[model samples]
Target: MKKLTRLEKYHMNKVSQRSNGKVVAITPEAMEIEQRAIEREKRGHYRVAARLWLQCMDVASGEVERARIAIRRQQCITWSNHTRQGEYSGIGCRGVVYD
Candidate 1:
């Protein structure tokens, strides 16, 4: 059998506990990540926000928290893709590099 990484082990444990109505308490780091992701999105750093939000999802306390993070991540992903497309089409903003 393949060895399970820490994250994979956590996911497996959560999946098993989920059936027993357990909820994992989120850490302070999870909250920090959520805040950072929000700030990044506000600053139009969609790609960065998307990645942070994905990390946040991994530490989310429950299904609702995960769902909220999922929505934010999806929105950032769409915005990131749109901006990239715009740059590719030579319609980038004046004096603003996408990076």
Candidate 2:
């Protein structure tokens, strides 16, 4: 089992509190997939990470909190596709055009 980060633990605690004390434990397999997704993101494999995040969202059913995850996954996909197509130039990157 991977150790949860303080942020992760804090999020879990918030979820539990929001759910009126119902513990929302993620399955080990889901945890493994999420870890892999994080690794992919760290490696600059944004598309793969986005797909893995979608898989994680699927596994995390029955909650409105999953909406946040879905939005983030969509953002990853959008950014990854834009970057792959050479259409994205934001804040600090090279070739950014400020208006």
For model 1, residues 1-99, the per-residue Cα lDDT tens digits are 567799966774465422323222245667888788878988989999999989999987566557656776888999998775423424654665554
Off by over 4 Å in 2: 1-28, 85-99
Local accuracy by lDDT, each model:
0.71, 0.66
lDDT of 2 by residue, 33-80 (tens): 777887787788889989987888778744544655566577678778
In angstroms, how far off is 73's CA in candidate 1? 0.4
Worst window of 10 by summed lDDT in candidate 1: 16-25
Q: lDDT for model 2, on a 0 to 1 scale?
A: 0.66
Report how far off residue 91 is in candidate 1 (Å): 17
Clashing pairs in 1: none
- What local lDDT does model 1 show for residue 48? 96
lDDT of 2 at 30: 55
